[model samples]
Target chain A: MSIPRWAWVPFGVALALLAVPILGLLVRAPWTRLPELLTSERALDALGLSLASCVVSTLLVLIIGTPTALVLARSTGRWTGWVRTLVTVPMVLPPVVAGLALLTTLGRRGLLGQHLSVVGIEIGFTTAAVVVAQTFVALPFLVVSLEGAIRTAGGDYERAAAHLGASPTRTFLTVTMPVLAPAVASGTALAFARALGEFGATLTFAGSLQGVTRTLPLEIYLLRETDTDLALALAVVLLAVAAVIVGLSQRLRGAHG
Target chain B: MTQRLALLVAGAALILPLAACSPAPDGPTVFAASSLSGVLPGIEPEASYSFDGSSGLVDQIAGGAPADVFASADQRTMERAVSEGLIDGEPRMFATNHLVLIVAKDNPAGVTGFDASLDGVKLVVCATEVPCGAATQRLAEANGLTLMPVSEETKVADVLGKVVSGEADAGLVYATDAAGSDAVEAIDVPGAEDDPNTYWVAVVKGAAHAEAARAYVDSLVGEWGDDLQHFGFGPPL
Candidate 1:
């Protein structure tokens, strides 16, 4: 394929900007210290906890946000816009504010917070809260992306299949869903990448603990104090993992495209 | 006329960048804790405060954030800067606060003492990284008790919130903070002093407005700095 001559300037510039940061991550990644860091039990524990929380957070967001996106995609009027705007509130609010708001509403002494103690159900300061916080911040990304895809897709395919006697659920499964799969997959990948890197809200809403609530990003932050090299090493690892998932998602999108 | 529309567009173009970059002149840009608001001068004659998390303030200092002066909730962050050579002079202990366990005022937990914060009791603590959280953890360790909290909050205020909101049965926070809450009752948590003492101060290194910054620091350390001690923050420097 022949490329346009004028496209090279901006395209090359954008590529350079993107590649420079990755190159820096490579140059300063502390490759030689990998053996020493990889051996530590605490490092393993922190990584495991981070993976567990990000997965649960992504799953919870998907379960709740998927239906919410469907409604937002189909609704009309000022009310729909307001509800859609409200759904995106977490994405706009500072993560710390979201954490504080969560605390005020769900903390031990909150309006509903007091009732939790009576049932012996505690949601703050644990692994579960880490998931909750990550989900709270990350769900909107998936919701917005999927909702946009669905709105652009329109409902005609499902409606046509239904007119031919296929059930609403069946038409959705067979016709409308296949086209939206790319958006769903990409949304999941974006949410996963975001959840993997979430720090402020997690730290604010879910306290960092070595084996308890300390996610990889939290560990990287704490490590910045006593161990700069080790912290950089963790950053490289986090970058690498997020990159691979993003790469896979792009490949999936391309195959579908 | 198209000329008026052009002038309006020109006006908006000129104002937009300046509006984006400038801080409002109304406030002091004071960075302190919510708990300290009541005890401090509350308002300077000229400037208003922009309260923020203590760790955030220290990070801002390290990152060359613009500020007149900084007042942290704990000494560790101030010391972190001192060790890193980011700040100018020594940071003194401006106030001291004991640890307290906060519960909903309704007392629905039927709780009374440190025992309520033990295992099986839902508790909220600052993540071990922050000063208050470390204090809570150290107190727990000194008492030979292990508390697996329901969640760990990044800021002390979040821990206070977990208790204030009733999400956790009890939360460990500074006594000064607990005292400020009407909906939450404070139970004296023993052995928090065994942990390192939290210090607050006014250290403005690389300040944009050095004169105003120095004045703020000066008022915080002198004999006139009695309001800090009066609020039970500890003996003022």
Candidate 2:
């Protein structure tokens, strides 16, 4: 099929806009110093912390978000619209605002936090806070993607299974889940990527502390202030990791399709 | 043809408003450190100001940002800018600041002094890259104390925010910042007086509004002394 001339204008514009920055990163990256910079204790620490927290948050998103997505998919009411809107609010809200919202509700002096503090338990500035910030921001990605998948898959198969003496739970577990596996895998990857890049919310809510809350983005921001070259190297690392995950997920989807 | 024209008109409608909202090219764009945020507003309310960490400002200036004046919270950053040929001339010292430990108004942690022995108290401080962070390091080294901060924030305002929100028990911030906010109380560090963090102001090369930038810098260096003093900043030495 021949592409229209006008379409190429916008397509080329979008391609150049996206590709130029990545090209710039490749051209300006301190290739010689990258080995030393990536191996530095601070860089490694941030990488380890980011991977661990993002993995935990992705699992949390899958567990909690799957049910929320399923509910939104099955329901058809005014309340469902409001519920879906509420679930996607964090995805649209500024990350810093999300952090402040979390802080006000979970900080030591926060409304719910004050009660928790009374029990001699603190959540702020802990590894748990990092997971909370990540999950809060990433849950929407999983839920939105899975809800779309569930809606597209429809309920015909599940209904047919139910009429044939299959229980609702069994039909969901055996039939609905397998059909949504590719969507789940893709959504998990996107959520994990989003969580890994989380900065403002993590910094504001969990605080930037090494081995606890200082993730890769926070480390890159700090390094940008002190060492630009090292910051570039770390950014390249993040770019590589995100690209690999996205690429793998696309391949998985293709295979499943 | 009509559809393409409509699309073109819609695009122009979007771009025109954004272009109008941008800072006027004729106005003096001042890139000042976040620590000077309080005083700069009082000094030159008309000039467009970009307030952030000095290093970030330096990076922006180096990247050819159209800034007229650069006010840094520390000499080291200004010196770096000069060495990089980002600024036009020598930077002049405009003001000085001392580090102080700040706590929430309620004093939830009961932080009395700047010593390291306050066990179990969660403290926050500026990251070492910024001026306030460097001053914090100097203060710690001089007093032979090891600070156990829960967070090393990018800027002084962030440290103040954490303290004001009671997320942190205490934070080491500029005397001006501590005095500027009623939500937090400042505790004077003993040796902080000896190592004052000086503010430096310089004009950027190829500034569009050079005269206006110079006047703004002069106001901060001369006429704004009383206002700076009121805001708890030390007189330029």
Score each candidate by Cα lDDT: 0.72, 0.87
Candidate 2 RMSD to the correct structure: 3.8
- Cα displacement (Å) at residue A220, model 1: 4.0
Per residue, candidate 2 scores C-alpha lDDT tens digits across A1-257 of 97565664465455555777799998999999999999999989999999999999999999999988999999998999999999999999999999999999999989999999999889888999999999999999999988998998878889999999999789988989998999999999999999999999988888887777889999898888878898899999999999999998787667656
lDDT of 2 at A50: 96
lDDT of 2 by residue, B1-237 (tens): 676555544544443454345556555899998877777777778898899888888988898788999999888889999999988877889888898888888887877788754457989998887667888998888888888888888768889989999988999988899888999988889899789988899889898899988887777777645888888889888
Cα-based TM-score, every candidate: 0.74, 0.93
Across A1-257, the per-residue lDDT of candidate 1 in tens digits comes to: 97555455455455555776789878977899987895687688888998988889899888887777878887888898888888788888887788777776776555676688569766766788788888988898889988988888867887788899998668767886787888778888888888888888777666666788888888887776456677788888898899998997787767556
Worst 10 residues of 1 chain B by lDDT: B7-16
